[model samples]
Target: MRAFAALLDALAFAPSPAVQVRLMADYLKRAPDFDRGWALAMLAGGFDTACVRPAALHALAAERVDAEFLRLSLDFVGDPVETAALIWPESGTEPCPPPLAEVAPALSSISRQAAPGLLARWFDRSDLPVRRALAQLAAGRRVPGVTPRLARTALAAAFSADLGAIEEAWHGQAPPYGHLFAWLEGRAPHPEAVAGFRPLMPVCPLDETALASLDPACCRVERQWSGMRVQLVAESGLHRLYSGSGDDVSRLFPEIVAAMEGLAGVFDGVLMAACGPDGPPYRPAPPEALARRLGRKTVPRRLVAEVPVFVRLFDMLFDGGEDIRPLPLRERRARLEARIANRTRLDLSPVLAFEAAEAQDAPLVLKPADAPYLPVGPPWRVRKAPPKTVRALLLAARPGGTGERGPDYSVALLRDGAPVAVGDAPCRLESVERDRLDRWVRAHVTGRYGPVRAVEPALVLEVAFETVRPAPRRKAGLALTRPEIVRILWDLPADAADSVDALNAPVSRPPTAGRASRSLPSGSR
Candidate 1:
């Protein structure tokens, strides 16, 4: 084991990947059973022993590798217990192979006698992915003999060793499914429950079977919305919005905060493109209209006026004094609807009926937990959405200092050549530093810019932009257009006195935005 640690340290400091591979291959050929297995796995990109041990077993079965070599490899791979279950080589649901489990107690005894530094060395030398797999085993299996020897503190410390490996693999973000699963299984810390949103075990695209198994009557289906998921927290008079990644979007959607001013309790929903006079809705807008607003952070006055935002307020997890998450979807909705007075910003999401056969293909519609509703035969459910459309804007364009084009022109959706909804096109510039100038051109320019040309509402704009001024900071930040038409409420144009009343009016978020949020499953993005 000491020799193995030295080998790993040397390899870790190696200047070249090729050199590391050579070192590992040499170890596999010469080291003891445990070391060889681990070394071979290191040489291979995937670290799980399930892969390497199986290959070894196959070679032995084919008589490609002799019993002598296999025994040596097994020794080098050594007892899993020696590595503190580092080798966690599983052979299905049955007990671990006799050779491995037979040595578990001996290995555990050795680990108990070893010093802290030695234990650390052992962990460091093991294949990281193998160690991760072993962690799973240690967490699941309750080995009475081994468990007692390794005091609670020592057991806890053993678990910590896997963190580095896990973090290295996940790059700061928690392991997507496995980490959460481990928490649910009581292998890790109890998951932190936030005030507004619960850490949902989201149905991964891979979990099509589980999704299909969903009780349609118990769940409601809706289009996976785009845009980032936002947890709107307005407690007392303080308002703050957090992205799924925990980024503060407090200033991004001031209108939403204002819209939610009177509403009690925290809420969760997608922050997406809204139209009409008000702001974004929790629900998806009409698909056709939202296509134009996708990926847009900044909405110009004309577009804002035409396609403003309104909260769809689809599902409610909490009310002023109640935690309704445990309640069925139908019950939650009924309570939520009863409390919600703003039809413009909050409304009930409709459900769709589908049979079990339809369940696999179509999404499950989530409902309140206590509802007596059942699918006609199989479980059917309700889902809600709004319509959407795409439109291209041709704002003024200009060439930049780097000789690259700066976007200026834009177009809007129009019924009779009058701007109904407006959106800008994707721009390519040196960097974000040049974005302010680009935004100015897009927002203020009167004529067509760059490659952009005016198109009817029938033609949608495929635009890409970041949040320039989604939320208001100052009086100038509130300005969107002239006195003719204002899009947002708090950020009304100073001169638009006549339109101020209309600008203050409420609107709905386009259905596309809702759909976008679902598709993206945003978290603080």
Candidate 2:
């Protein structure tokens, strides 16, 4: 437990990725196998069952400390679990803390009623850093800068194993990963084969200057669809859907899973929702349409019908258990087109002529025709026009997080001749500019809403964004994508700022069918 806590503390403050990987690799190399496996699982956001609710932790803290002091500490810390861990009283004679191997299983099986007593005992046995790590684990939060991928990378580094093979063998295995550890230590054969997610290849923005250098005959162009990138795996009677980050989201989209019932291959594509039947002219729906179906534990039949999704096939990674990723892109595309012929819920992304694609006034993706499907590379390139800029009225200021020194500014646009809050400006202002805005906000406060302060809409800000999309859930009825403050517009009148209609103009086009065709079985919904 102490070693794991020390790893967390070191990882949180590691200055660089190289340093973080070194620290994690060192810890993994030295910790006991059982402890190492559990630590790895925690770093990968597993062990979700071993958690105490934030409200319960707060209640426990109030019982031990003064209510006023607890409230003040909470406001200062901004995290309830951290505040509770800091305010926990220390014992004069501390008992030796239990190992992670013993602690993990006990916490996993603990009931809500028994959790408080167990936590108190553990807090009494551990010091400040260990107590904080234990509290964070109980609250189901990973330390900052440590992601599942980074954990895998560190493990690979620790054992000097192939990272790609490790990733391919990782998904279906559970923690503590005894078999995985045995395989890493060469004490056992590879784990049983399962149709798990393969990491998706990354895409880099196509530099405008390099466009002329690309060979027209050696590259293929496809429209960059606005949807999530996903890998669909159907092999050996196992069908699953994975987000690009390797999360198993099979249950979230049952219709898509059912549509792939008989398929046996690994496919890379964009998963998107569309209106109307799942065939022929594929109308591309807004991201919000697909957003409605994500993150739900159970997909109600009505919601599934309302937001039907389909995958536009990009490339075939596996063809009937054969690892075809070593083949060139041209061969992969040929195999993909042949595999999904006359299939519903799956269709090939049509390839356009380079000149034709260049002439179209839309975003495009360019792929090298001869490159093999590598998990990590820049074989895919996207081309989008520069972001558009608009002048918006600054409406309010929200308090920043723990280490942020300045308040975050909320900007708005005119809708029906009234200012409607659209989103926050994430631009990091220069110290002088930040001070100026802070002074203005402090002087012109209107109303208070918790940590946010409403300010008079007397200032205009020049904001630049990549695109605008219809956001039905927002008061403005639209939302900006990747917006950042270009500069402050102190002289511009607030009334002269752009209206919501201005941002909505480009997105007002009627939904046109993309390269998609599919039909879902009635039983699937």
Candidate 3:
């Protein structure tokens, strides 16, 4: 428990990625096998055995400390677990906390009714740092800067193994990864034919400057669908669908798995909800429409029927048992077309002529005709333009954390002449601008909602965003994607900011179908 707490503290406080990696590697090298495995799982967000709720923790804290003071501490700290850890009265008992292995299983198997007493005893046996770590672990809160990729990278560095090979072998395996550790320590052979995730090939954004140098005939253009990027794997009699980040979501989309029953390959594609029922002339539903079907453990039959999904194959990574990722784009595309021929719930992403691509308004994905698939660094991407911007009024400001002097701003749009909170604008303001805005916000405070201050909606900001969509749950009945404050419109009046209708205009109508590319195989369409 002490060692794990130190690791969490080191990771949280370390600003440099190199230092963090070194710290994690050191911990991995010395910790017991089961403890390290569970630590790795927690760091990677793969641990899901939280038994205590935040409310229960708060209630426990209130019983020991003054309830009103606990509430005040919670508001100031902005985290309930942290508040509990800090305010917890030490019992001064000789600390004898259990090992991470025991704690992990106990938390997983313990009943909710018995959780508070057990947690209280653990708290009494722990110091401040260990108490905080235990609280965070029980609450399932991730430590800052610790990610799955970072954990894998640290493991690779610790074991002196190839990072890519480690990533490929790490997937589809659960916690206390005994076999993985044994292989790393040379006590066991490398796992083979393990039907695991392959690191996805990501793309660099294509700007007009780079596009101008490319010849149209040497490139292929495909409409960049606003849907989830996924890899469908069917190998060694195991079928799985992985989200781009490598989450095994095979359970969420069983229809997709059923479609690839007899297939044997790893295919890279977009998983999109059909605008209507599955058939030829398939149109992609808007991103918001597809979002409804995501993240659920089980899908109701009625919902599945309402939002049917299909994969549009863009490239083939593995053809049967052969690794074809080294093949050029043209060859892979050819193989993909031949492999999924006549298969339901699968279609080829039509290749478009340069002229045909330029005629469309939707975002375009451009790939080199001869480039090979290079996992983690592909020479292909969506053609990007400057994000659209709009003037929005500042509605509230949430106090920033740690060293930040300025508060985070929440901007809003006008609906029926009333300002409705839309989304929080990220802190991209220049230092001078931030200082000026901070001063103004401090002066114009109207009311308080915990750490957030309701400001006099007088300041206007130029908020740039990539997209907007219908979000019925938001107060404005809309949501913005990648919203960032470009600059403050100091002279502009708040009422001069854009309206809800103005932002809604673009996405109001259903998506229009693009002209099918002539290069697509006839059978694919």
Per-candidate Cα lDDT values, in order, are: 0.38, 0.80, 0.80
Better of 1 and 2 by lDDT: 2
Task: Give the candidate order by descending TM-score.
Answer: 2, 3, 1
Residue 11's C-alpha lDDT in candidate 3? 85
The alpha-carbon lDDT assigned to residue 504 of candidate 3 equals 51
Q: What is the TM-score of each candidate against the true structure?
A: 0.32, 0.85, 0.84
Where is the poorest 10-residue window by lDDT in model 3? Answer: 509-518
Which candidate, 2 or 3, would have the higher TM-score against the true structure? 2
Where does candidate 2 clash, by residue pair?
278-518, 282-513, 282-514, 283-513, 345-518
lDDT of candidate 3 over 298-344, digit per residue (tens)? 99988888889998889989999999988889999998888888888
lDDT of model 2, residue 159: 95
TM-score of 3: 0.84
The residue ranges of model 1 lying beyond 4 angstroms of the native Cα positions read 1-201, 206-215, 278-307, 355-525
Error of 3 at 272 (Å): 3.1
The candidate that achieves the highest TM-score relative to the unseen native structure? 2
lDDT of 1 at 308: 47
List the candidate 3 regions with Cα displacement exceeding 4 Å.
Answer: 13-23, 59-80, 185-187, 295-307, 342-344, 376-378, 397-409, 420-424, 447-453, 467-480, 500-525
